[model samples]
Target: MLDGQSFLISRAVPGSCEQESKWIYMTQHLLESSSNKRPPSQESEEQEQGDRGKRKKSPECPDTPDITDTEHALDLSDRQGSDGDYDDANSFINPLGRDITISCLLRCSRSDYGVIASLNQSFRSLIRSGVLYKLRRQMGITEHWVYFSCNVLEWEAYDPYRGRWIAIPKMPPNECFMCSDKESLAVGTELLVFGKEVTSHIVLRYSMLTNSWSPGIVMNSPRCLFGSASLGEKAIIAGGTDAQGTILSSAELYNSETQTWETLPAMNRARKLCSGVFMDGKFYVIGGMASNTEVLTCGEEYDLNRRSWTVIPNMSAGLNGASGAPPLVAVVNNELYAADYAEKEVRKYDKENNAWITLGKLPERSVSMNGWGLAFRACGERLIVIGGPRGSMGGTIELNSWIPNEGPPEWNIIASKQSGSFVYNCAVMGC
Candidate 1:
């Protein structure tokens, strides 16, 4: 029988030991350079916290040593390794080349990445460099995880693939942020939660790589209640009211790789409380209030290749009510689907006819307040509905899903837990 190391090598490379040994190591300097520094989000948070006030420590967000301290330790490790104190441990795997090691790691479930990073300095560096995830993307290997908040300060993630729930670190306590309206979006490996803090707006970011929350970079417009959507490593926010309470036609695009926002061409009409989605390789903004009293029935499409917007009349007809939340919309396989909260039904967009066709009813027990507290999103290949049942004594949140096909909808109750009946925010991250 093959030994343990030989078996692992065979599984990763699928050939003789000679073939496995041929795999060349990735450039050491590149890996170290990418992973050695702290993420910009963390560095910014440290500065912001000092400017704001002393933060109260929570159980979930225990105090972590500064990245500078960690860097010092790494320097010591490097010196010791040069002296032969830890020659083998310096490599990602003891004897196997890094190229082969990363091949096996890419096949491992994403849920195990956190645990794997904790094993040693070398493993941690590889994971933090973000190379592995980028390579995985190029290979078209991905897993989708759902992130949502039931309480003001708490967030939870559900791994649909593994059917496991993960508790995210609690957001820093702020009276203004806790009580204000918020919106959420997941781009790349970061989950951004936007809210108002007193006179100005603030963004709190949670990084999957670090498993920590930090102050995020604010947009150029710095508005609330905007329509936003993500595609791969980038996200776009469009058509929301500025801090001055003026409806804005301005928009911005965010690139997670650079952690920067680039201003985009404004839409034809200014609106707020709209919804955004990516479909058929284009971005669409639909159904929002033109002003305090004027509700817009039109939708706008942005063509990335052309860098322009086309206004489609009556595209969002009857979708947004005067006082309801933004139209609950999501896209799967380049097809648009929306949740009709008032009608308690699911509808598909008929682009050819410029209309919506009712598919089926929503979950019977799922409840919402004028479509405010319900989350309807596309989770990979399934349509997901997250909400609480009506008339429950205390509170209970349920996650129901259905894979769309030729037939009508038949949802499966995947998970439920005790929490506030209302969802504060929700976003799905596919990576």
Candidate 2:
């Protein structure tokens, strides 16, 4: 509901030729791209036309313009300088010298304000040594709630603004209420949690206003370690291990309005611990382990409107373990990113060009156990990594905010409690 304005700030050295040229090139790119798009709104279009008419006519060029030739030559020199300066400047900045800090405003009910404040203070001390790049307020689902399968299947709402996590009423336990490696996705006011116990199944509906969980529908097949994402009004679940411990290629969809689960076409290959993201109205499934025998290079996509699956380019590196859970696939500046659990590297996928590039490596080693409960969210404009194994729970980092002059940022520990929270398989709701 917050329609805040987004701003960009640049602080390069004054009059630096490399910085100036790069800025100009980026501006030109934006101008050309905008020109090809649809015209601005009617009022803005009229304003633009009026401004054009008000411009004074330029003087006619002489037989040979004095500045034209020099300008043309300088353009070529600037282009050459751009390439060299980019490389030189990048080399000068250490890849590991950057630091980022992430802050979140915890809002809870008036009764639980003190608890929320404690969390905020604890988080501040946890990452006080690092730079903060992200700050987000957690979205509350009714009065302070937390949903867990093993427990009473309760719901709690946390108010980051008030600093509280309040527990809501309990839900009726269904026939099979157990879910391991549970993954949840949020669409509007509904939360969809999918997991596998003895069967691969999904718990469809949880409303923040209702403050309770009700059975909406179940998946066509039960799956574990699957990837889930929300696109518009629908939630998509794809690629996971079935009851038999075999990786699965199938996918399912749940329409929030219809309150039903429908089968979509399966993926190209069986994958568990794969990363999935919904971007530009499509679902992208990336790397994971297949059959416990091989790490998969398979990637696929499902069209929301068409209800079809298509094989897409695979990831640069295969991922497995805790790295393939709910928030693994993150969209930063229109590009898809996933941390390769097996490779300990982060990769970015360019949807426009169908290419994969290594963004960088994780600050620490990879963790392979209980690969679930990892959560990633955009705090402000920076991507915040939270709650994964191998020093991840308290660990946080910024995405793509680094520049050549600024160097690669460091991961700051945000929450160091020994709660041993599963980073990959947990549900995250943020404002």
Reference-based lDDT, each prediction? 0.74, 0.44
Q: After superposition, how far is residue 138 of candidate 1 from its true place, in Å?
A: 1.5
Task: Mark the 10 consecutive residues where model 1 has the least summed lDDT.
Answer: 1-10
Error of 1 at 187 (Å): 0.2
RMSD (Cα, Å) for all candidates, in order, is 11.1, 20.8
Clashing pairs in 1: none
Q: Best candidate, lDDT-wise?
A: 1
Clashes of each: 0, 43
Looking at candidate 2, the ten consecutive residues that score lowest on lDDT are: 44-53
lDDT of 2 by residue, 267-322 (tens): 87877877677666678887777756566665777887787777765553444443
